[model samples]
Target: MKFLATCPKGLEPLLVDELTALGAEEVKQTASGAEFSGSLESAYAACLWSRLANRVLMPVTEAVVETAEQLYAAVQEVDWSEHLDQSGSLSVNFTGSTKSINHTHFASLKVKDAIVDQFRDRFNCRPSVDRDQPDLRVHAHIYRGRLVVSIDLSGESLHRRDYRTESGAAPIKENLAAALLYRAQWPKCATEYPSVLDPMCGSGTILIEAALMKADVAPGLLRSEHGFERWKQHDAQLWQTLLDNAQQRREAGLASLEPVFFGSDIDTKVLNMARANAERAGLSAFITFERRDVKDMAPPNEAGGLLVTNPPYGERLGESSALMFLYRGIGDALKSRFGGWRAAIFTGNPDLCQAVGLKTDRVYKLKNGPIDSQLFLYTLYRKSAEQLAQAEESESQELSEQAQMFANRLKKNLKAMRKWVKQNDIDCYRLYDADIPEFAVAVDLYGDWVHVQEYAPPKSVDKVRAFDRIKDVMAAIPEVLEVPLSRVVLKQRKRQTGTNQYEKQGAKGKFFEVGEAGCRLRVNLHDYLDTGVFLDHRPVRRMIQQEAAGKDFLNLFCYTATASVHAAVGGAKTTTSVDMSATYLQWAMKNMAANGFSDKHQHFIQSDCLVWLKKQRKPQFDLIFMDPPTFSNSKRMQDVLDVQRDHVELIRLAMRLLRPEGKLIFSNNYRRFKMDYEALAMFDVTEISAQTIDPDFKRNTRIHSAFEVRWP
Candidate 1:
C-alpha cells in the first residue's frame, strides 16, 4: 500500500530518509511531505519511531474532480463498510480547491453527505459526524482539478508529543526542534561529548526531545490515542507486539543512557514549567533546569558538550540593537566557559548572526512557522586565560608599517583642514577618501564619532590581504583619531545596483544629531549604508542657503530632505521635497521640523521624482535643487533611471517647472558622466563641478559633478 508522510516544508528530505530507514520502499519526495510504499507493520513502526513526521496518511482513492457532484461521487465510490461502521463517527478534512469547487467547507459537506447517504441506503442508518475522536478521519486534497482522498493514520500532528502542558510565548514546535538537532548532528555529538545544553530552553521541548531520542523511547507511546486505534481495520495483535518490543527497548535504552542534559531560561516561571515538563516526560533525573541569563551561562560539568539554543530574533523595529549585545554576550560566554565544544544557534534574523563573532562551519535553512530561519553550527576551541590576555594585549600594541602609513596620512589631512573647519564652524567633514591606493576606504567625522566605509576591492586583489588591510585600518582609525573604539562604526561599501543601497542593514533605529553649516540633522551610523546626512554635499547645501531668500524652492530626490532643511533655514518662501522612499521622506519631515520649518508651506511629497515632475504643467518654483542617483531600477519607478541616458529628459522636465530667470542646480556622483551639450542647446548650462569642491574634498575632485541650468 502507498503511504504519505506529511511534515514541515523544508524537512521533506529528512522525512524521506526517516521513512526509508523504517523499512519503506520506493520513497519519493514531494512538496511539504513525502510518499512511499509500505506494509501495515512498516506504517506502524514509522508512527512509533519517526521523530520528524507530522502525519502519516494512507491513500484510499483518487479521481478527476471539477465540480461538487463529481467530488461527492468519487468519495461515495470507496467501500464505506470496510472503513467505518454505520454506528461509528467520522470526520472529513478537506484541503486545496479547483475552479469549479472553490470552497473547502462546501466540498467537505458534499463528501460527508456522500459517505452518510451510502451507509444509510445500505443499512437504514448512518455514522454521525464527530470532529474530535472520530472512528475514521478522511482527508481530501484537490490540486489542478484532481482529487485524492486518504485516511489520516496519525491524528493530531505528531509535534504535540503530549508532554508540554504549559508553554511560553512563541515556543518552537516539538518536531522542528528535533529537525534542528538532526541538522546540528546532536546524536553524533551526544556520543562524543556525552552532554547537551539549551541556554534559552523554554518549556524544555528540545531537552525532552533529546532525552526521548537518547532513552530510545517511542514518541507515539506518550500519546493517549492514534487515528488507527478506532478504525475498522486496526490489528490489535500486531500493534500489541510492536508496543511490547518498544517497551522492552525503552527500558534497556534508559538503563544504558548516561549522557547528561541541561536547560536554562531567564524567567523563573518558565524554568518551573520546563522542570515540570521534564518530570512528565520521565527524564527529570537526566536533565536539569535552572533560572539563569545567557551572559552567566557556564558548562554544567568538566566534559564539554553541544550548546544549542533558539535565541530571540527581534521581529520588531529597534529591537536589534539590544539583541546584538545579547548575541555578543552569548559568543563571549561560549568562548570563555564552554571551550572544546560544538554550538548551534537557530534564528530568523540571519543578519544578526554576524554579531556572534564566530565563524560558522555549516548553515541549514529551515522555517519556524511562517518565518524563514537558519541554523548555524560552529566548533569552539578552548582558550586559556593567559591566551585571552595575550590576544587583548596584542590588539592594543603598536601598528604595522602599512597601518602607520595610513595613520600619518589621516593626520596630515586633518592638519590641512583645521583652518577650513574652524572658519566654517563645521562639525562633520570628510577626513579621507581612499587617498592611498592600498588602503581604499572613506572616513568621515560626524562630530566626535567616526564612520568608515571600506570600498570593495577589485577581483584582482587578494581577498585575504584586503581583509588584513581592513583590519589594519580599523585599528589605526581609533588610535590616530583619538576616539574610543566603541565610537567608531565600520561598514562594507559595495557597488549597489537597483535599489539595493536603500535596503536596511540593521534594525537598531539609532539616530544621532550632527551640526553642519548651522543646521542640525539626524544621522544613523549603524542602521543604514549611508548616514541620513550626506557629508560630501556640504558645499551644495551651503550654496543653497546662500541663494535662497523669499523664493519658492524645490528639492528633487531629496533623500532625508537635508537640502530642503538648508533652504528653509536660508529663508526660502516655501520648500517642497520629493522622493520615492516614504522612509526618507519621513526623515526629511523630521529634519525640517527640527529646524522649526513644520509649517504647511514646507511640503514633503513621497513620489518618484520622474513621475511627479512629468505631471506638473506649471512653472512655480524659483530655485530648484535636483540631485539624483546615478542609476536606479527601483520597482516603485515606472521606468529605469540612468543619469547619462535620461539626464536630457529629466533636465527638460525640471526646466518646464522653472520660472523665467530661475536657476536649476543639478548634480550626480557618476564619475564618467558626460554633458549632452547639443541636447540642451535651448537652455544655458555651465559646469560648476570645480566650484563645488571644498578644501576637505579637494583630494577627489570627481566626488560629484554639478551644473547650473538656466533659461537664456
Candidate 2:
C-alpha cells in the first residue's frame, strides 16, 4: 500500500522522519506532506502514532482534470464499491482549485455527484453524504489542473486529540503544538521521565502531548473509529493486535512514568479546561494544573525541568504594548526563578521574544494555523552571586567603545542636573534626556523610582543594535543611580491616534504618592502611557500656580486634573476642570482629593472640552488653562479637532470667554506647531514655550508648546 501522511507547511521533514520511524518504507517528502510505501498495518500505525500528520491518505486514483466535467469523470473512475457500500454514508474533502473550479466546496459537490451517480447507476442505491463520522472520508487534491483522489484513513485530522473539548483564547492547533514539543526534544526527555511545565498553558495541549508521548500512548488511541474500519478489506485482527499492544504499553509506561507534568495559567477557567482535558486524556492523576500568573511561576520542585509555553503574541487589536510588558515580565520571572531549567517559548511575534532577555540556543520555524511562528529553545542557568557580580564587572569593562561613550555622557548629565534638582527641591526630575543620540530614552527620577520612556528609533536605525543599546542603558541605570531593579519602569513611547491616550493600557490601577511643588499627587506608573503627572510640565504647572491667585480658574482637557490641583494649591478662588473621559475625570478628582483640594469649589466635569468651551456663558474665568490634544476624533466629540487648523477659532472662542485682563494658557504637544498670529492679532499672544520647558526636557524643546493669550 502507498500511504501519504499530510501535515502543515514547513513540517514535511519532521513528518517524513516520523513516518520512517513508524515502519514506513521508501519515504519521500513533499511540500506539505510525505509519501511512503508501507503495508496496511504501517498505514494504520501512521494513523495512530504519527503526531504531526494531519491525516493518512491511501491513494485510489489520479488523472488530469482541466474542467469540472473532467474532475467528475476522473473521480467516477475510482470504483467506489471497493471502499464503501452503496448504502453507506460518505463525504468528500476537496482542496486546491483550477481555472474551471475556483471554490473547494463546488469541487467537493461535483465529486460527490460523481460517486452518487456511479453507485445509483450500478447498484440502484446511492451513499448519503455524512460530513460527521462518515463511513468513507474521501480527500481530493487538485494541483495545476490535475486531481488526485484518496481515502482519509484517519476519520478526522489527527490534531484533534479527542481531549480538548474546550480551549482558551488563541489556542494553538494540537499538531502544531506537538511539533513544537518535538523540536524542543521533549520526546527524548520523556524517556528520562523529566518534569515538564507550561507556565502559560492555555488548555494544556503541550502538557497532554508530552504525557501521551511519555506514556507510550498512541495519539489516536482515544478515537473510537478510523475511516479504514468500515472498509470491506479491513483487517480487524491486525488492528486489535496493534490496539492491545498499545494499551499494554500505555499501562506499563504509566506505571513507570517518573516525569511530573505541571500546567499553570493566569486564568482559573482556562486552568480548569486544562484539568478536564488531562482527565479526558486519561492522564489526570499524572499531571497537576494550577492557576498562577506567568510572572509568579516558579519551579515546581528542586529538580530542574523543561519550562515551555505558548505566550500571547499581541496579534489582536490594542495588545502589543501589554504583551510586550507580559513578555518582559516572563523573561524577568524566568531569570529570577527558573534557574538550571531548559525553556522553550513558542510565539508568533519574534520581536516580542527579543524582549525576553535570555539568549536563544536554537529556533524552529513552524506555522500556527495561518500565522508563521517560531519556537525558541534555551537553557536557563544562572551564575552564582559572586560570579554574577564578576560578570557584571566584566560587562561594564567589556562595553563597546560607543556604549562607553554613551555611559560617560549619562554620567555627565546626571552630575550637571543634581545641583539644579536639589536647588529646586524636585525629587523627580530628568537626570538624562537623550544626552547621547545613540541612547534615545529620557530617564527621570520619580522620587526614588526611575521612569524611562524609550523614544522610537528612526527608520535609519538598526533596531537590533538599538535594542541592545537600550538594554545597556537599562542595565547601567540601576547601577549608576543606585536604585533597585524593581523601581525601574521602562515604557516605549509611540505616537498616538484618536483616543489612544484615553485608553487604559493596564488594569492594575496601582498608584503611588509622589511629592511635587509641596503638593502630594497620586502617580500611576502601570495604568497608562503617560505617568499620572508629566515631568516636563513641572515648569508649566508652576507658572499656572504663580498666575493663579484669588481668581476663577478653568482647565480644559484637564488630564488627571494635575494643573487644576496646582492652581487650587496656589489659592484659586474657584476651579473647574473639563475632559471628555469619565475615567480621567475620576482620576482628576482623586488627584484633587489627594492634594487636600476636595472642596466643592474644585469641580471636575466630564464633557468634550470643545463643546464645553462653546457653552461657557461669558468671561467665567480670570485664568484658563486650555491645553487641548494635538488631534482628536473621539466618538464623544462633536467634531474632529486638529490643533494646527483650528487653533485660530479655538483661541478666538477662549478669548470671547476671557475677561479683558484674563489670561488663557493655550498649549499643545504637536511637534511642529505654528500659531495663527494674523488671525489672533486682536489679542496679545506671547509664546512661552521656551520658559515653560523644564531643564530635563530642554533637548526636545518642542516637547510641548505653550502660549499665554490675553485680551488687552
Candidate 3:
C-alpha cells in the first residue's frame, strides 16, 4: 500500500528517519510530507511506534485533473463502491495546492458528489458525508497538476499521544514531542545513562512521551480506535497478531528501561494538569512532575541525564521582554545547575535564544501547532581539550557521525534559524555571537569563500562579552589576510538605528603583507563596515582591477573609495569617488595617497551619489561600482530608497552615467531579489554572483549578487 506522512516544513528528514526505522519501505522525503510503500501492518506500526509524523495517509488513487469538472470525473472513476460501504458514513477532506483547481471546499464537494452519485447510480443508495467522526476520512491532495487521494490512518493527529490530559499554553503535540527525543542520537548517551527531564514541562507532553517511551507502551494502546479499524481491508486477525507482536517487543524494551523520568514547571496548576494527563494515559506511575521555576532547576539524583524544555516565545504566550531574561536564566541554569546533563529547548523566537548561553549542539525545525518553532539540542558533557584535539585530528571520521549525536539538540534551533535566514533573505547574517559558550567560530560564507574566525567566550555574560565578540569579528579579516598591525586603522561606528550600533566596526588597523602568496592586497581600517574595501567584493574588485587598464572609473556611494583605489592601482587614467561622507572621501584619499596617488589622478566628490549621478548629463567613465544599502531613508538625502523596489531605477540612472560599452557593476545583500531583466533589456547583464561573494559569505549566496551591465 502506498502511504503519505505529512510533516512540518523542516522535519521531513526526521520523519523519513522515523518511518525507515519502523520498517516502512521505499520511503522518500518531501517538503511537507513523506511518501512510502508499506503494508497494513507497517501502517499500524507507524501509528503505534513511529514519532515525528503528523498524519499517516493511505493512498486510494492518483490522478491528473485540470478543472472542477475533471476532478469529479477522476474521483468518480476510482470505483467508490469497492472499499466504502454505501450505508457507512464517510467524510471528504481536500487539500489543494498550486493548480488549475484550487478551492479545497469546492474540490472536496466535487469528490463527495462523485462518490455518492456513483453509489446512487449503481447501488440505489449513497453514503452521507460525516463532518464529525466518519467511518472513512478521504484526503485529496492537489499538488501541481495532479491529485492523490488517501485515507487517514489515524483518527486524529497522532500527536495526541493520549498521555497527557493537562494542557498548557503553547504545548507541543505528542508525536512531534516524542519524535524529538527518538530522532536524537541520545541512545548513544546510552539507554541507561540517566533520567529524562523537562524543565518547562507545562502539561507534561514531553514528560508523558518520555514516560510512555521508556515503559515501551504503544501509543496506540492508549487509544480505543484507529481509522483502520473501520476500513473494509482492516483484518482483525492480522491486527491482533500485530498487537501481540508489538506487546512482545515492548516486553523486551521494558526490561531494559529503568523508571527514570522528571518534569518541572512554574505553574502549579499546569503540574496538576500534567499529572491528570499522565493518569489518563496510565503513565502516572512512570513520570514525575514538580512545580518549580526553570531558573532554579536541578536534575534529580539521576546524573548525566537529559533536560528538555519549551520556553515561552512572546509570539504565542505574550511573555513580553521578560522572556529574554528568562532565556538568560535558562542559560545560567543549564551551565551552572546541570553541567553533566543534556538540554533541549524549544522556542519560536531566536533573539531570545541569545540569552541562553549554552552552546547548542544541534537544532531541528519542529512545529508547535501552526507556529514555526525550533528545538535546540545542547550537549551537557564537556570533553577536555585533549579529547577535542583527538577528535579533530582523526582523519577517518565523518563529520555527520560526530555531529549527529550532538546535532539533534541543536538541529531544531538551526532549522528555526535556517527558516528565518531564508525568509529575511539574509543567509549570510551571523548565526551565533561568540559570547555563546557553545559558539566558537564566527563563520560567514560569502558565495564560495568561508570566513571563519575562532574565539572563546568571556567568563562574564555582560556587555564585555558581546563587546569582545565584535572585536573578535573585526580582527578576523586581517588575521586571514596576514596583514600587519600598522597598516590597519580602526574606525568607530556610530549608533545607526537599523544596524547594530553596539557591534564594533569591521575595519581595524591595516595590514600590508610584504609578499603574501594569495591575493596580495592593501586593506584600510577604521569607520563603519567598509574595510578599505568590502571583502565580499573580492571578485568584483578583481574584475574592476582587470577592466581598470586605461579606463575612467566611477565609484558611486563610494565609501572610502576602495574600488577607486583599486581602479587606480589597476592603471585607470582617471578615477572618481562620489559619496555623502567627506570623512570617507578623506579616508579614500589616504588609501590612494598611501599607494602614491594624488589629486591629479584621483577625483573625490562629496555629494549624494543618487543626486550626483542625476546631475552628470554626459557619460564619462568606462566602469562604475554601484553597491547600495538594502534600505535607507535619510533626512540629509532627498529620496528614500529600497533595494527590492528601486534596483531597476538605480541601474537605469547609473547606466546613463556610463560611457558606451562601459560596465555597471551592481551589488545588493537582498538574497531573494529578482532583477527586472525586462526593464534593463537595453544592456547586457551577466551574473557574477559566484565570483563576487568571497568564501566568508557563501553559506548563502544571493546573500549578495554582482551583476555586470554594458551596452551591446
Candidate 4:
C-alpha cells in the first residue's frame, strides 16, 4: 500500500525520516508532505507515533482529469461499497485547480455527487455528508491535469493534540512548535542537559511537545478519535495491540521521566492557560508554569538547558520601533543569564531579529500560519569580565573609516547647534542635513529624543553600499549624540505622491509634547514619516506670530494646526484652519485644546483649501498663510494640485478672501519652484525666503521658498 504523510511546509524532510523509522519503504519528500509505500502496520504506526505529520493519507486511486466530467468519472471509478457503505457518512476535501475546474467548491461537489450516485446505483439509498465527523474523509488534489485521491487516515490535523482547551492571542500551532524543537536538536540536548525552558511560552505548546518527546509518549495517544475508526478495513485487533503498547510506554516513561520543563509568560492569564493545558496533556507533574516577563527570565536550575520561545512580531505597522526595545531586552536577558546554553528565538519579522544583537548558528525558514517565519538558533557562551571589556574595545575599533568620519561630523554639528538652541530656548530643531554627501540623512532633536530621516539614495548608488552607509549612520548616532538606542528613531524619506506622505508607517499611537516658539505641539516620532512639527518652519511660524495680532487669520493646508496655534497665540481675533484630512483636522483641534484655545472663535474646516476658498465671496480675513504640498493627486480633491502650475490660481483664490490692506504669506518646500510673477502682476509679491532661514537651517538655504503678497 502507498500512503502520504502531510505536515507543514519546511517539515517535509523530517516527516520522511519519521515515516521511514516507522517501518515505511521508499519514503520520499514532497512539498508540505512525504510519500511512501508501506504495510498496514506501518501506515497505522505513522498515524499513531509520527509527531511532525499532520495527517496520514492512504491513496485509493488517481486519474488524468481536466473537466468536471473527467473528475466525476475518476471518482466514480472507485467502488463505493468497498470503502464506505450506504449507511455511513463521508466528506470530500478538494484542493488545487485547473482551467476547466477553477473553484474547489465546485470540484468537491462533483466528487461527492459521483460517490453518492454510485452508492444509489448499487443500493437503494446513499450516504449522507458529514463535514464535522465523517466516517470516511476523501482527499483529492488536482494539479495541471492529474487528480490523486486518498482516504484521510487521521480525522483532524495532527497539530490538534487535544491538550489545549484555551490559547492566548496568536498562539503558535503545535506542529510548528515541534518543528522548532527538532531544528534546535532538543531530542539530543534533552539527554545531555535534561531541562528545557520557554520564556514567552503561551499555552505551553513548545514545552508540552518537548515533554512528550522526552517522555517517549505518542502525540496522538491523547486524541479520542481517529479517521480510521469507522472505516471497513480498520483492524481492531492490531490497533488495540499498538494502543496497549503505547499505554504501557507512556506509563513507564512518565514514571522514569527525569527532564524538567519550565514555561513562563508576562501575561498571568496566559500562564493560567498554560497550566490548564499542561494538566490536560497529563504532564503537569513534569512541567512548571510561571508568570514572568522575558527580561526577568532566568535559568530554573544550575544545569543549563535549551531555551526556546516565540515572541510577538508586531504585525501592525508602526509597532516595530517599540518591539525593537523588547527584542533588545530579550537579548540582554539571554546574555546576562543563560550562559553555556542553547537558545532558539522564532519571529516573523527578520528586521526585529537583528535587534537581538546576537550572531546565529543556524536559521530555519518556516511558516507560522500565513506568516513566513524564522527560527534563529544560538549557542550562548558567557564571556569573562576582562573578555567583555576587550570585546567592547574591539567593537569600537571595528568601525569603518566612513563610520568614523560620520561620527566626527555628528559631534561637530552638535557643538555648533548647542549655543543657538540654549540661547533661544528651542525644544526642537534640525541638527544635521546631509552635511556629508555620502551620508545623506537629516538628524533632528525633539527635546531629549533624536529623529533621523535617511534621504533615499539615487538609482546610480549600489543598494548594498547604500545600506552599509545607513548602518554606519545608525551605529554612530547613539554614540555621538549621547542617546540610548530606544530614543533614536530612524526613517527613510522618499519622494511621495497621492497622499502617501500622510499614510501611517506604524500604529504605536504614541505622541510626545514639544515646546516651540511659546506653543506646545504634539509630535509622534514612530507613526508617520514626518513628525507633527516641521523644524524649518520655526521662523515662518514666528513671523505669523508677529503679524497676527488683532487680525482675523486663515491658515491653508493647516496640517496639525501648528501654524494656526502660533497665529492664535499671536492674538488673532479669529483663526479658521482648513485642510482636506479629517485626521489632521482632529489633530488641529487637539493642538488648539493643548494650548487652551478651544473657543468657537477657532474653527477647523475639513475641506480642500482650493474648494473652500472658491466658496468664499467676500473678504473675511486680515492675515492669511498658505503652505501647500509640491504635488497632490488625492482622490478627495476635485482636481490635482501642482504647486508650480497651480500657484497663480491658488493664490488668486486666497487673495479674494483677504482685505485690501491684508497680507498673504505663501510658502512651499519645492526646491525648484518658479513663481508666476508675469501671471500675478496685480499683487506686489516680495520673496522673504532668505529671511525665514533661522540659525539651525542656515546650511540648507533652499529648504523652502517664502513670499509676502499684498495689494500693489
Candidate 5:
C-alpha cells in the first residue's frame, strides 16, 4: 500500500528515517508529512516502532477540487461502499493550506457530506456520522487546490499509549514525552549507576514511556484497538503476525531490559493512576508507584541517581505568582539535596527560571503545541571547601590581573546596552546575569541560571578590558528580549563551585517565594547559596494534596524537606524525615510543623539516612521517597556518597523494608548517570520526569529524575 505517515511539523525527516529503516520503498518527504510504499509488514512495522509520527494514512484517492461545488462533486465520484458498510459508522477530518479552502472544519464537513451522499445513492443506505467511535475514519486535506483522501489507519492517537490509568492536571502527551527522552539520549540513563526519576511524575507518562524504551517493549502492545482493525480490507493473518512479532519483541525486551521504574507525585490519585496504567501495560512487576512531594524528596537509600523531570511554567495553565513559587522551591531542593547528581528540566516559561538555582550547561529549543519550549541540561556539581580553596590558591597573579581586566571591560560594554534598552520598549530585562565568555562569570538580578564559558588569560590590560566588553554587550541583550530592567537582574556570579574564590564573588543572592498557589517553603538561600525550593518538582508537589491524605510518607536525605512540607499539606498521617545535615534536618522539621505536622505524627531524624536504614524495623511504608545528593561528605558519615556510584545498593536497601505492592520512589541529578544493569536485574525502573514538571519552571527539567521499583 502507498502510505503517507503524518507527523508534527519539522519532523518529516524523522519519519523518513524510520520508513527507510523499516525497509519500505520509495520513502519521500513532504512539507507537512512524508510518503512511502511498502508491503503490509512494512506498514505494520511503522505502526509499531515509529516514534515521531502522528498517524499512518493510506491514501484512497487524489482529485483536483477547485471550488466547494467541485469538491463535493469529486468526493461523490468515489465508491464509499468499498471501505465502509451501509450500517458502519464514519467520521471525516480535514486539513488545508494556502488556498481558497482555509477552514479545516468546513472542509471536513463537505467531505463527510459527499461520502454520506455517495453511500445513500449507491448502497441505498448511508453510513451514520459517529465521530466518537467511528468504524471507518476518512481524512481529507486540501493543499494547492488538490484534495487527498485517505483512511485513518490509526484509531486513537498514538500518544494515548494506553499506559496511563489515570491522569493529573496538565498531563504530558505520552509519545511526545517519549520523543523528548529519545532526543535526550535515553540509553545512557538506563545504563547509568543512578536511577532515572521524575520527581513530579504526574500521570507517569514519561515514566512509563521511559520504562518501555528501556525494556524495548512494543508500544502498540497496550493498544486495544486500531483504525485498521475495523477496515473492510483488514487482514486477520497479517495482524496476527504483527501481534506475534510485537510479542516476540516484548520477550526479547524483557530479556534485555532490567526493569527499574520509579514514579513520585504529591497526588495520590496520580500515583494510583500510574499504578493502574503500569498494570494494564503488563508492567505490574516492572514499576513502583509512590505519592511524594518534590520538596521533601529524600533518597529511599543513600545512592545518587539521575533526575529527569518537567517542572511547571505558568504560561499554559495558571498565574505567574504561582509559577514563581514552585520555581523557587526547585532551586532550593537541587542545591540542598541533589548535589553531585545531574538533571534535565523542560519548560516553556523563561521568566520564572529564577527558582531552579543551578547553572545550565545546554539549552535546546523545542515546541509544545504553539508554545516555544526549552530543555535545560544541568550538571549539578558539589565541590568541597578544600577543593574551592585549592583552586583559588592554584591560579597565578597574572590570571588575577586578567580577571580584573575582564570585569572592567564588561563595565564599558554596558554603556551600549543601556542605550539600546532606552530606545526599545523593554523595561524589565536581563542586563548581565550569566553566559559571558570572557568573564567566565555572570549574575542576573533576577538571574539565577548560569552558563559558564571557558577562556584563556589576556595578554594585556586592553585585552582583558575586551573580555569585560563582551559582558557589557551581553548586559544589553535584555533589550532584544523585550523584558524590562526591573525584570532583568545583574550582579557578580555567586555559585556553589567555580574556578576559584577570587574569580567569583557575591553576597547572598536574592531569596524569593515559590508561587501564589497557597504554598510557602521555608528555605534559606544563603547558607548553601541556593534558594530553598525545587522548581522542577512543582507539579509533583501540587499532586500531593490530591493523593497524600491518610498516607504515611518516608523522606530520605530530607534536605530542608520541602517535599515533606507538601506531604503534610496533603494530609499524610505519619511523616518520617531523615537527613545527615543537622541544619537542613532542622529546617525540614520546621517546614513540616509549620504545615500542621505535629511531633506525634511527624518525625525528623538527624543522622545518615542510609546508615539509620540498617536498623529498619518498620514493616512497610505506603509511600517511599528518596532524593539523595549526587555526592556528599557529611561530618557525621565517614564515607562519601556518590549518587551515580551507589544507587543500586541504596535501592536494594530501601527495598528490604517495602511492603508487598508498596512504592519506592528515588530521584537524583547525575546528568550522565549510567545505571548498573547487572545490579538492577531483579527490579523494574520507569522514568516519569516529563509529567512531574509544573507551571513555573515548565521549560526546565522538573526533577533531576525519578524511578519506580516494581516487582512481581
Candidate 6:
C-alpha cells in the first residue's frame, strides 16, 4: 500500500527521516509531506512513533478531472467499503480548489454526496456524517484538475498531544516544539540523560516534549481515540501488538529515565498551566516547573544541560524596543549564570538575535506558524575577567572616531555635572542627554548605579553602525563612571502607549534605594523602563514640597507618588495620592514608608483621577498637584484622555475641589504644550516652566511645563 505522512511545511525532511527510522520503505519527500510504500504495520507505527507527521493517510484512488461532476464521479468510483462500513460514520477534509470548484466546502459536499449515493445504491443504506470523531476520515486533495483521495489514519492533527488541557498566550504547536528539540540534538542528549530547561516555557510544551523524548514513549500512546481504531482495515491484532510493545517500552523507559527537565516562567498563571500539562502527561515527576524570571534562571542542577526557549519576538508595534532590552537581559543571564549549558533561541526577528551578544554557532530557518523564524544555536560560556577586559579593550580600539567623540562628550558632561550635583546634594541626576546627534541616548546616574535610555535611531541611520555606537556608549559609560558593567542598565525608549507604560519589561525584582531632596525611595532599574521615578521631575517635586507646607495637598495621577511623598515630608496636614495602577500605589506606599509618612494623613487611593476628582465635593484640597499623561487610552479608565483636548476640563474639575485660597499646580511632559489662556480667564495663572527646568536639563528647554493657578 502507498502511504503518505503529512506534516507542517518546512518539516517534510524531518518527517521523511522520522519515517525512515520507523521502518517505512521507499520514502520520498514532498513539499507538504512524504510518500512511501508501507504495509499495515508500517502505517500503524508511523501513526504511533512519527512525531512530526500531522496525518498518516492511505491512498484509496486518484483521477484526473476538469469539473465538479467529474470530481464527484472519481470519488464515487472508489470502493468506500474497503475503508468504511455502510453503517459507520465518516468525515471528509477537503484541501485545494480548482477553477470548476472555487470553494473547498462545496467540493467536500460534492464528494460526500457521491459517497452517500454510492452506498445508498449498493445497499440502500448510507453512512452518517460525524465531523468531530468519525469512523473513517477521508482526505481529498484537489490539485489543478486532479483529485487524490486517501483515508486519514490519524483523526486529529498529531500536534494536539492531549496533555495540553490549557494553553498560554502564543503557545507553540507541540509538533513544532518536537521539531525544535530534534534540531537541538536532543535525541543524542536523551541517551545521556542531560538536563533540559526552557526559561520561558509557556504552558510547558517544550519541557513536555523533551521529557517525552527522554522516556522514548510514543507521543500517541496517551490518546484514547484514533482514526485507525475504527477503520475497516485497522488490523486490530497488529495494532494491539504495537500498543502492547509501546506500553512495555514506556514502562522500561520510565524506569530508566531520571528526572532532568526544568522550566521557569515569570507568569504564575502560566506556570500553573505548565504544571497541569506536565501532570496530565504523566511527566510531573520528571519536570520541575517554577515561576522564575529569565534573568534569574540558572541551571536547575549541577549537571550541565541544554537551554532551549522560544522568547517573545515583539511582533506588535512599539514592542520591539522593549523586547530588545529583554533579549539583552537573557543574553546577560546566559553569560553570567548558565556558562556550561548549550542554548538555543527561536525568534522571528533577527535584530533581537543581534542583541544576544553571543556568537551563533549555527542558525536554521524554520516557519513559526506563518512567520519565518531562525533557530540560533549557541554555546554559552563564561568569559574570565581578563578575557572580558581584553575583549573590551579590543572593542574600544575599533570604535569609530564619531563614537570616540561621543565618549569624550560624555566624559566632559560627567566632569561638569559632578560639581553641580555635589553642590546641590543631588544623588540622582542626568549626566548626558543626547549630546551628539548621531548618538541618541540619555545617561543618568542613581548613586552607585547608572540607567542608559537609548532613543530609537532614525531609518536613515545604518543599523549596524547604530548598534556599534550604542555598544560604544555602553562601554564608555561604565569606564567614565568608574562602575562595574553589571551596575549599568540599558533600556530603549520609544513612543509608548499609556497602557504599556505601566507594563513590567523584566522580572528581576531587584530594587535599590536612592536619595532625592531628603527623601529615600526605592527604584527598580531592571524591571521597568522608567526606574519607578522620573529623573526629569526633580525640580517639579521640589517645588511641590516647598509650596505644600501646612495645607491639604492632593496629588493626581501620582505615579509612584513621588510628589505625594514630597508634600507629606513638607508638613502637609493631609495628602491624598490618586493613580490607576495598584503597583504604583504599592510603590507609593513604600516610598511614603521610607520617608516616615505612612500614617493616615498620607493616603494613597487607587482610582481614575478624573472619576475621583468628579466625586470630590465636600473634601476640598488646599493645594492640588495635577500631572496627567499626555495621552491615555488605558482600558482601566472609563474615558480616554487627550491632554491637549481635555486639559481644560481636567483643570476645571480639579479647581472645583480646590478651596477658595487654594493653589493648583498643573504640569505635563508634553513638549509642545500651549496653555488655553482664554479658557482659564477666571483664575490668576502663572507659567513656571522656565523655573522648573533644573541645571541638568539645561540642554532641553521643554522638558516639562508647569503652571500655578489660583482664584485671586
Candidate 2, residues 402-422, lDDT tens digits: the string is 666776777788887888887
Supply candidate 6's per-residue lDDT for 169. Answer: 84
How many clashes in each structure? 0, 0, 42, 4, 117, 0
How much lDDT does candidate 1 score? 0.88
Local distance difference test scores for all models: 0.88, 0.84, 0.69, 0.88, 0.65, 0.86
lDDT: worst 10-residue window of model 2: 314-323
Candidate 1, residue 373: the lDDT equals 96
Error of 3 at 283 (Å): 1.9
Evaluate candidate 1 by giving its C-alpha RMSD to the native, one decimal: 6.6
Better of 3 and 4 by TM-score: 4
Error of 3 at 182 (Å): 3.0
Per-residue alpha-carbon lDDT of candidate 5 for residues 1-712, written as tens digits (9 for 90 to 100): 7998877654566568767977889999997568999887777777776666678888888898877777888787778778888899998888774356667787788889999888788778888888888889898887788888888888777666666757877776775676567655674555543456788888777777877877777787777778888888777799898889878888898776644667788878778887888788777676677887887775443355556778767532113333454665676666655656667787887645645656787776666667687777776676687765664565322324444555454455455456754453222222333234545433322232222222323435343244344334334433333445334332222222221211212233443433213445564333233345554555555565456688887888777777777777777777788887666676676666566566688888877877888778665666677887777665567577778988988888887767766677787766666667578888777776666643223323522676767664
Worst 10 residues of 3 by lDDT: 512-521
Give me the overall lDDT of model 4.
Answer: 0.88
Candidate 1 clashes between residue pairs 3 or more apart in a chain or in different chains? none
| Residue 512 displacement in candidate 2 (angstroms) | 3.0
Q: Which residue runs of candidate 5 sit more than 4 Å off their true CA positions?
A: 10-16, 25-32, 97-105, 298-305, 316-325, 328-342, 354-361, 380-712
| lDDT tens digits by residue: candidate 3, 1-712 | 8888887676788789878988999999987779898788788888776666768898888887788888888887787666679898788888875456667788888888988899999999988878777878888888777888888877777766665655877677777777677645544454545688888888888877776666667777777677777776677898888788878866776666665778888788888898899888766776788888787787687456887777877641113223555787677666655656777787776656866866778887766667777888887665567765674566234433323423343344345566654543432333322323443444433322223333423447453344333334434433433445333232222223332311234223534321111223344322233334455665676678778999999888787677777788788999988877766677677777767788687899987777877787788888999987776666546787678898888898888888987889998767677888888898899887887764435554665777888888
Across 552-626, the per-residue lDDT of candidate 6 in tens digits comes to 999999999988888888888999999999999999999999888868898889999998888877737999999
Highest-TM-score candidate: 4
**Candidate 1 local lDDT, 106-152, one digit each (tens):** 99999999999999999999999999899999999999988999998
Candidate rank order under lDDT: 4, 1, 6, 2, 3, 5
Q: Which stretches of candidate 3 lie over 4 Å from their true place?
A: 97-100, 251-256, 316-320, 382-712
- Error (Å) of candidate 5 at residue 160 is 0.9
- List pairs with backbone clashes in candidate 2: none
